[model samples]
Target chain A: MTSILSGLESVKQALASQQFALSITQRNVANASNESYTREDAVFADVTASGGAAVSIQAYRDRFLDFSIGQEMQSLGKQQAQSSALSQIDSIFNENSGQGLQEAFSGFFNSFSSLSATPEDLTLRQQVLSKATALTSELHRLCAGMQRVQYSVNSSVPSTVDEINSITSKIAALNKQIPGETGSGNEFALRDERQKLLENLSSLIDTSYYETESGSITVTTGQGGLLVAGKDSYSLESSPLSGSGFQGVQLGGADITSTLRSGKLSGLIGARDQITGYLTSLDDLAATIAARVNQQHAAGSDLDGISGTDLFSYTTVSTGSNSGAARSISIAISDPRKVAAAGPSGGPGNNENANLLFAVKDEKLFTTSTETASQFYAHLIYRVGSDEQSAAEEITTQKSILAQLKNQRDGVSGVDMNEEAVNLIKYQKAYQAGARFATVLDTLSSDILNLIGA
Target chain B: MRVAQSETYRSFLGNLETLNERMNKLNSQVSSGKKLAQLKDSPASSAQLIGMRDQAAEIDQYQTNIDSGSYFLGMADSIFNEVNNLVTSIYAKGSQSASESVTADDRATIGTEIRSLRDQILALANSQVLGRYIFAGSRTSSAPFIVSGDTVSYQGDETANKISVDRGLEVQEGVPGSAAFNSIFSAVDSLLSNVSSNNMDGIQTALGQFASALSGLGIARGEIGANLGLLNNAKTNLGSQETSLKAQQSQVEDANMAEAVTGLSQVQTALQTAMTAGGSILQQRNLFDILG
Candidate 1:
C-alpha cells in the first residue's frame, strides 16, 4: 500500500511538472506578437528528494534584451523627431518652386534691362513701373509668409509647455501605482502603462528614466526637473500668459527658460528665431535697395529737364507717428517737348541725361566692393544661391543619415513577421507536447489509484 | 585598417545622396535663373540682389532719359546752325546794301531779307519737341523766347535737367532752352533791327552780336558732342560688366553638363550595386525552406 501511494505521489509530481511546462509554453505562444514580451521558460527544480521527489517550475526572463530594446527605442524616437522637423522646414521654403522671391527679383531686373534699351518709350517706362510694383509686392508676400510662420510658432510655445506639464503629471501618477502593484511581481500591466507614458513624454521632450529600489521609475525632463519621485508626483503648474488662456508651464513659479533642445517644440523655436531672423534681414536689404535707387533716380534727369521727384518710392508702412500711405510712385518726364525735339540743347549740358543713363551701364555698379546698394545686391544673389544649395545638401545629408540610423535600429528592433510566424509554430508545438505530457501523467496517477483500491 | 560593410554602405549612400541633392538644387537654381529662392536662402544676398536689380533698373531708366535728352539737344543744335546760316546769308545781302553805290530800293530789299531771317530765327526758337517747347527748359509748355519789334526775351528757367549716370556720378542732360538758344535769338533780333533801320554804327554792333550768338551755339554743340562721347563710354563699360557678371554667375551657380552627366552615371552605378546586394540578402532569407 505504501509503494502504491509512493507511485501515486511520483505520478502526481510528474503531472504537476508537466502542467507547469504546458502553462509556460502557452504563455510564450500567446505573447509571440507582443514586442515587449520576452520569451519565458520554465526552470524546473526537483523538490528535496523527499516524499517521492516532487517538482516546481520558475519563470525565467533575460533582462539584457529588455534594456537594449529600450535604448534603441529612445534613439529611434529622436531620429524620427529630427527628420520630421527638417522635412517641415524644407517644404516651407519650397526652393524648387520657381515662384519665389528670387524669380521676382530677376523679373524686376529684366524689366530694367528692357527699359534701358528703349529709354524714351512711354510703354517701356510703364512696364518698368509695373515691374517695380510686382517686385515690391513679392517682397511683402515673403515677409508676410515669414511673419505667419513666426506667429504660429509663438502661439504653439505655451501649448507645448502645457502638454509637457500634463504628461509629467500622468507619468507621476503611474509611478506611484507601479511600485505598489509591482511588490507581488505582477507589474506587467503597470509596466505597459508606464511605457505608453514614456513614449508620449519622449515626443514632447527628450527624457531620462531613473529606476527606484522598489522597481518603480522616476521620470525626469530634459531640463533636469523631477517629474516623478517614488510614489508621489511633483505637480507642475501652468502659468497663464497674462489674460490669455495660453498656459506657460512653470516648474517653481519661474519660467522654463531653457530652449527646447529637440523635438517639435525645438523645431518651432528654430523657425521663429533663426529662419525669421534671416527673412527680416532680407527685408532690410530690400528697403535699402529701394531707398538708394530712389535717391539716384531723383537726382537723375528724366525726359523733361526737371529732377527731385523720386523714381522708385519704397512701399514700406512706417511705424512712426507721421506716416504717409501713398503706394504709387511717379517717374514722369520733366520736359516732354525736349524728348520730342531730338535736340541736344533741349536737355541739360546738351543731352547729359542720356549720357548719365549710358554711364550707369558700367560694371562698376555691380562689381564695386563698396557697401552700396548695387554691390549689396550682387553679393546677395551669390549668397542666396549658395545658401540654398548648401541647405538642400544638408537636408539630404541629414535625411540619409536618418535613414541609415533607422536601418541600423530596425535591424535590431524591427519585427520580422516571417521570424514571428516560425516562432508561433515552435511555441505552439511545445505547448501541445507539454499538455500531452500532463495528460499522460494524469493517466498514470489514475491507474495507480485504481490498483491500490483493488 | 578595415571598414564595416554596413558603415561603408551608409557613408557612401549618404555622400551620394548629398551630391545628388546639391545637383538638384543647382539645377533648380539654374532653371529658375534667380539667386534667391527664399529669404532664408541668403538674407543679405536676397536683399542685395534686389537692390542691385533695382539699381540696374534705375540706371536703365536714366539711360532712357539720356537718350531723349540727347535727341532734343541734337535738334536744338541743328536748328541753331540753320539760324546761323540764315543770318550769314542776310549779312551778305546787307553788305551789298551797305555799298555807297547802291540805291535806296536795294537797301529796302536787304531789310526785307533781314526781316525774313529774323522770322526764321524766331520760328527756330519756338520749335517744339514731343509737343512741348524744346528750348523752354522746365517751362516746357511755352516757347523758350519771345520776339517783339527788335528784341527777344528769355521765357524758360535757368536750371538744367540732371540725371544719375552711375554711383556717385550725375550728369546734366538738359540745358535750359533759354540759355542755349534764347540768347542767340536776342542777338539775331538786334542784328535784324539794325540792318532794317540802315544805321551803319548799329549794323556794326549787331554783326558782333550775331558772331557772339553763333559762337554760343557752337559751344552748346561742343557740349552735346562731349556728352554723347561719355554716354558711349558708359554703355561700353556696362556691356562688359554685364558680360562678366553673367560668366561669374554661371561659374558659381550653373552646372557643367558634362560633369553632371558623369556624376549621375556614377550615382546610378552605385545605386544599382546597392539594390543588387539588398536583393540578394532578401532572397537568401527563406522561412519556408527552413520550415520544410
Candidate 2:
C-alpha cells in the first residue's frame, strides 16, 4: 500500500537533509582560517526508530582551559606594565650615558675639592657655585621624572576601569544574544565572538565566567565580584582622588583596587607603589645631602670673614624631610665669598672648611650609616635596574606559558582546512546521490500513472 | 596539543623579541664599552664604582695639596741657603774684628760692611714669593721686619703655618720670620756695636751669638728638608692609590670588549636564525598544496 508518491516524499526528505549537511561543511571550509572561529559539527537525532534526522551546530569549549588562560593573562598584564615603568627608571638613571645624577654629584663635590687649592681664586669659587646649581637642577629633573612615571601609572588606572566596563557590556550583550541565536544558524559565530571578548576582558581585569542553565554566560571579576549575570552587566566605576589622587576601580560601589589579584589594574597598582618607594629613597638622599652639607657649611667661615651661613638649604635646612627635598634643594649662599673655606680659626688663608667639604664625600653619614652619598645613589640605581631585568625575564616566561595554554585550546577547537575540504566533497556527493534518488522515484511514480491511464 | 596559527605566530614573535632584546643589550655594551651603562645594571658594582671614583678624586686632591705644599717648601729651602751664607759671612767678620791684629779704621770699615750685610739679610727674610710674604706666618699680607737704628722688631707671629699634604699629614708651609731671623738680627746688632767700639772682648762675645744664630738657621733648614721629604712621599703614595682606585672603577664600569663583541655576534646569529625559521614557516603552504 506504499505508493510511488509517498516513496518520492521519503526521497525528498533525504535530499533536504543532505543539502543541510552540505551547507554546514561549506561553512566550516569557508571559516577554517578564522582564529576566533571554532570547528563546528552537526548533531543528528533519531525519530520513531527510523532514519529521521534533526541537526544542531556544536561549538567547542573547555571551561578549565579558559579559566587558566584568564589567570595567565592577568599575570602577563602586570609584568608588562612593571617592565615598561622600570625601563623608564633605568634610562633616567643610566650613569655611563651621563643622563643620571652621578656625574652631577661628582662634579659638585669635585668642585669643592678643587676649591681647596686656591680658596681665594674667584674662578674656583664660581666653579663651586656653578656645580652646586647644576646638581640642584639635576635633582629637580629626577624628581619630575619620578612624578611623570607615577602620573602615567595613576592615569592608566581610570582607562583600565573604562576598559573593564566596555568589555563587561559586550559580554552582557553577547549573553543576551547567545540563547536567542542558538539553533538559528548564528550560535557558533556568537559563541566565538563572546570567547574573543572574554580574552580581552581577562587582560583588563582578572575574571572567571560560567555557562548558566539557560545556555547563557555570566562573567565575574576579581574575588567573585559580579560583572555580568546572564543578560545583565555591572559597570566598573572610578572617581578622582583628593589632591594628586589616582582614581581606583570600584565594584558594587566598593573600591576593589587592593583586592585586584592580577591584571592591568593590579600591575598599575604595583607600579604606583614602586614609584612611591623610589621617590621616598630619592628624597632621603636629597634631604641627607642638604642637612650634612649645610651643617659643615654653616659652621665654617668664608673669605669675607662671615660665618654661620648655609651653603645648601632645602625646606628646614637642618631637618631633612622625606618629601620634596630634592626639588627644594637650592644654593643658600648669595655672595661667592659666602662659600665657607675657613676652619675654627676662621683665617682667610684657612682652607680647612673646604677640606671638610671634600671629606664629606667619603663620610659614611647616611641614614644607613654605612654608605656615603655617592654609594647610596648608586645603590638606588642598581635596585631599579635589577627590578627591570626581573620584569623583562618574567614577561618572556609568562608569554611562553600563555602560548602553551593557547595551543591546548587550539587542539580542542581549531579548524583543520584539509579535513574540512574532504568533508566538503563527501557531503556534496551524498547530496547529489539523494537528489538523483528523488528524481528516480519521481520517474517511477510517473511510469505507474502512465500505465494505469493506458 | 595542536598549535593554532595565532600560537605559531606568537611563538615566532616571542622568540624574535627575546633575541632582539639580547641584541640591543649587547649592542649597548659594545658601543658604550661599559658593563655599567646604568646604575641598575649592577647596583653593588655601581655603588662600589662611585666609592672608587670618590677615592680617586680624593687622591687627586691630595696630590694637588702636596704639589702646592712642595712648591712653597722648596722656596723656603732655597731661601734658607741665603740665610746661612749671610750668617757665615757675619761670623767671619766678627772673628776677624775679634783677632786684635786689626786697626780701628779697619774695624770701622768692617762694621759698616757688617751693617750693610745685616740690612740685606732683613730684606731677604722679608722676601715675597707669589705675591705673599713667604716667612710672615699666617699674616702673609705684609712684611715681617721693622728696622730701628740698632734694633730689629719681629712683627711676624712664630706660628708654624701648615698645608695639608695628605689625609692626616700636614707639612709646615713656610719658616716663620721670627724663628728664622730674630736671633740673627740681634747677633748682627751685637757684631756692629763691637766693631764700632773696637772692643775685642765685646767682638768675641758677639761671635758666640753669630755661631748660635747660624746653628738655629741650620735647624730651620733641616725642618724644611723633612717637610719636603714628607711631601714627596705623600705624592708617591697618592699617585699609586689613584692608579689602583681607577683600575677598580674601570673594572666595575668598563665592559670587556672581547666578551661584548662575541655576545653581539652570538645574539645576531640567534636573531638571524629565528627570522629565517619564522619566514620559512610563514611561507609554508601545507594546506594549500594538499587542497590543490
Say which candidate scores most in TM-score.
2
Q: After superposition, which runs of candidate 1 have C-alpha atoms over 4 Å from their true positions? A: A1-140, A162-166, A169-200, A230-248, A257-259, A275-454, B1-59, B62-66, B178-183, B258-284
In candidate 2, which residue ranges exceed 4 Å CA deviation? A1-35, A44-53, A240-244, A316-320, A439-454, B1-3, B38-40, B89-134, B142-178, B181-204, B210-216
The digit string of per-residue lDDT tens for model 1 on A386-411 reads 44445445445545545554344334
Q: What i-RMS does every model get?
A: 8.6, 3.2
Candidate 1: C-alpha lDDT? 0.54
User: Which lDDT value does model 1 have at A79?
Assistant: 39
Tell me the whole-model lDDT of each prediction, alpha carbons only: 0.54, 0.76
| Per-candidate TM-score against the hidden true structure | 0.68, 0.88
Worst 10 residues of 2 chain B by lDDT: B1-10
Q: What is the lDDT of residue B235 in candidate 2?
A: 87
lDDT at A255 for candidate 1? 55
Tens digits of per-residue lDDT for model 2 on A1-454? 2666666666666666657777776776677667677777665543222335555667677768877887888889888888788778767665556545877887787777667645655677788899899989998888888889888888888888888888888888889988886676698788888888888887777788888988788888768999999889999887765544677778888878778877788878787878778877888888888788899988888876678487787773344346778878888876787788766545555567877886787688775699888878877776776777677778878888988887787777766655566666676786788688778877887898899999
Q: After superposition, how far is residue B5 of candidate 1 from its true place, in Å?
A: 18
Model 2's alpha-carbon lDDT is: 0.76
